[model samples]
Target: MIWNTLQLALREIRRNLLRSFLTILGIVIGVAAVITMVTLGNGATKSISDQVSSLGSNLLMVRPGQRMGPGGSAGAPMFKIADVQAIAAQVSGVKAVAPETRKSASVVVGSRNWSTVATGGTRDYFTAAGWTLSSGRIFTEAEERGGKAVCVIGSTIQRELFGGGDPLGEMMRVADFSCQVIGVLASKGQSAFGSDQDDVVIMPIRTVQRRLTGNQDVRTILVSADDGVSTDTVKARVEKLLRERRKIGENEDDNFNVLDTKQIAQALSSTTRVMTTLLGAVAAVSLLVGGIGIMNIMLVSVTERTREIGIRLAIGALEHEVLLQFLIEAVVLSSLGGLVGVALATGASLGLSSLMNIPYLFNPGINVMSFGISALIGVVFGFFPARRAARLDPIDALRHE
Candidate 1:
């Protein structure tokens, strides 16, 4: 009896192929939109986390001010080079410390001039930031002590300034001072926030203090913890030490901020997950609309097949069999639409993820869940029309046709 009912349902659907396709169109679009939005949003969140992790495995950032962001501290005292030395000497579990200061400068090698940020830090800055030298060597200790006019170039600057030629041992003008390029850094494409991490010139801290900015104030400090040390533990230690060094009373708030890359990644990932949920919810509204479309079409199908239904009843077919047939048809239609939509979404996700410069992650759980929900929608909505067809009196249904 079940096989017979399924055969009848398939026959009815096959007889009106064009109409069937049109009815299921809503399901296709709805499923595709939901899957595409979720897949892309997840990829974006993963990309953010990956980039943040690439900054360093165990890293802590210390800066003046009670908060972090673009806004500078108005009354907060900037950190001095002595602070970097103190942190290095006093802090336990610390692998390295890099005190940094930066300013915007125009770089020139003869007529090929380009504008970029000029940064000054000790060699530990590279180690703390997980930077590698592509070629040449880091600034010598003697050069660092003497405040020598030497610098390293990032990948972007190397490309923009040197083209195909080697930049090693070349003299480039940074602001008013001429500096020799001693090394080139390996590529670190971009930050999670979309800033070009490689668009900079790096020199020793003293060089920038004397030549460019003419100040001993440090803007940021990068700290790398020793192996197996917890970043949170390092952050806590740094905070406690700074609070004591700054002479803040127990009740008074410390004037500096200690942040780790893991904390930043988690915060950003949480925010992104919330946004993804909202987008997915918005996309799900269409599935409800699609369910209504399936219901409406099923109602029309029952009306047109009223005569056939009467004949089936006259031939000793049970009313429940007829009900099951219609319900099955609805489920088949919705499930088929879901499968096609998943295929479409997979293609779209691959293309869009590449265009957006992120990874394409396949989520089998979402695919199965979406397909199951679509079938469930069909059952819930198809019940009304199926029941209406089943409850029709044979005489009345025959008379109407």
Candidate 2:
């Protein structure tokens, strides 16, 4: 009996194929939009986490600023090599510390020149910054102590200045001084903030201070904590030590800021998730609209088949059977829409993820839940029309043309 009723429902839907397709269009669009938004959001969250992790594990960025941004550090005293030494000596659970300064300068290699950022730091900078060389070596102890004019170039700089040729053992002019290239850094690709991480030149700290900036100021200090150590603990300790070193009174506001990369990752991920939920919710409104469409069309269908329904009732067909047939038709229509929407979403997610340079993360749970919701919508909305058809008096339905 159930199979026969299902067959009758399919037959009725097949008779009005065009209308059936149009009826479910809203469901298709709603499902596709929700899935696409959520998939992209997940990908963006993963990308943020990966980019932050690339900065280094258990990392803390200590800057001489009350805030972050262009002039947030204005009127604040700059740190020195002594501060870096003090942190390395006094801070427990510390793995390495790097004192860093930066200058924007144009580098010339023969006829080719590229404007890039030049960073100055010691060998510990490599460890703290999670940098590794693709070729050659870091600064020798003598080169570091003497502030020799030698540099290591990032992948972007190497490509721009040297093309496919080897950059090692080559001399490049930076600002007013000539520096030999001792190493080429492995590519780090783009940062989370969308800047190219590989567009840089690195040299000994003293080299940048002496040849480029003509200063002894350290702009930033990077601290890497030991594995299994809490970055929060290290950050607090660094803040305390710096306060004493900078002579900030107990009631005075801090003159420095310590940023933890893990906290940054969490905050960014949470923001993306909230956005995803909002977008998904906005897209879900169309599902309710689709359900209303199903109800309206089913009402029209029952009216058009009124005479047939009356004949069935007159010939001993049960009222429940007639109702079940119409309800099944509605479910089939919605379920079909859901399947097609899933297929469309898969293609859209793949294309968009590639275009956006983010990963494509498929979520099966959402797909199943969406499909289930659509099926349930059919039952909720289709019931009113189905019940109305079942309750019609046989004599009255037959008399209606």
Candidate 3:
């Protein structure tokens, strides 16, 4: 009985191949879109998390900035270099602190000149930043104390300025001061915020302060805490110490900002997860539309094949057999579409990621879910039409059509 029903379903589909294909196209496109979008979103989130983790899991940045007012204007004074020293000395669980000074300077190596960002900091900055030297060595305590004109070129600068030749021991003029490149830092690629990580150069903190900014203060500080210390605890202690040292009243807000990258990453992940769910919900509407299209086609198919259904009913076929036949046909059509959709989506995702320079991650779980949902849609939307065909009155259906 099942074999007979299967044969009939195949014959009907073969006779209306064009109509069957058109009916399946809706589901094919919908399933493909959902899988592709979700995979891409997941890959992006994973990339962001990896980048954040790369900056060391226990790092914090202290910057000189007041809380912005409604108009985005600074409401308090900036933090000074004294705050950095105070944090390093007073805060418990703190491993190291490096005060930073930044400047945009033109680097001149004989006739070759390139404009790049310069960061001035202590030797601790290298360790706190998870940086390693590819050649030469770090600045000594004497070099930093004497404010020697020495600099470390990043990998990008090393490639751009020095080419194949060794940049170490080579002197390059930054702005008005001539500094020797003592070290070449390993490449860090790009940051999560899309900044070129290797484009800048590093120098002794005093050099940038005295030579470039002409200020005795540092703009920012990078802190590394002990492995077992909690970030919030250290942040609170540092805040209290700074407030007392700076003579801030209890009612006044903080002048400096202490930011933990791990906390920022958690917040960003939460926000992106919400966005992914919302987007997935919106995309699911297309699948619903596809289901509706399948139902409409099935109903039309029942009406067009009324005589055939009547003939089958007059024979040895039972009502349940008629229903199962139509149900099987719908499942076959939708399952085929789902398989094709998966293939197309995989190719499209790879192509799009390559073009956009985004990471491509093929998620098996999402693909299986899509395929299962497609099959469910087929069963749900195909039921009504199958019932109508099964309940057909043999005499009336045969006479009318």
Q: Per model, state how many residue pairs clash.
A: 0, 0, 0
TM-score of each model, paired residue for residue: 0.97, 0.96, 0.91
Per lDDT, the best of the predicted structures is: 2
Tens-place lDDT digits, model 1, residues 75-161: 788999888998899999999999889999999988898999999989899899888988989998888878999999998889888
What do the candidate models score in CA lDDT, each in turn? 0.89, 0.91, 0.83
- The TM-score obtained by model 3 is 0.91
Per-residue alpha-carbon lDDT of candidate 3 for residues 253-315, written as tens digits (9 for 90 to 100): 777778888977887777767776777777678877888888899999989889888888888
Between candidates 1 and 2, which one is better according to lDDT? 2
For candidate 3, give the lDDT of residue 135: 87
The global Cα lDDT (0 to 1) of model 3 is: 0.83
Q: Is candidate 1 or candidate 3 better by lDDT?
A: 1
- Candidate 2 ranges beyond 4 A from true positions: none
Best-to-worst TM-score order: 1, 2, 3
Give the range where candidate 3 is weakest over 10 consecutive residues by summed lDDT. Answer: 67-76
Number of the top-ranking candidate, with TM-score as the measure: 1
| Per-residue C-alpha lDDT of model 2 across residues 213-303, encoded as one tens digit per residue | 8999999999999998899999999999999999999999998899999988998899999998998898788777888888998899899
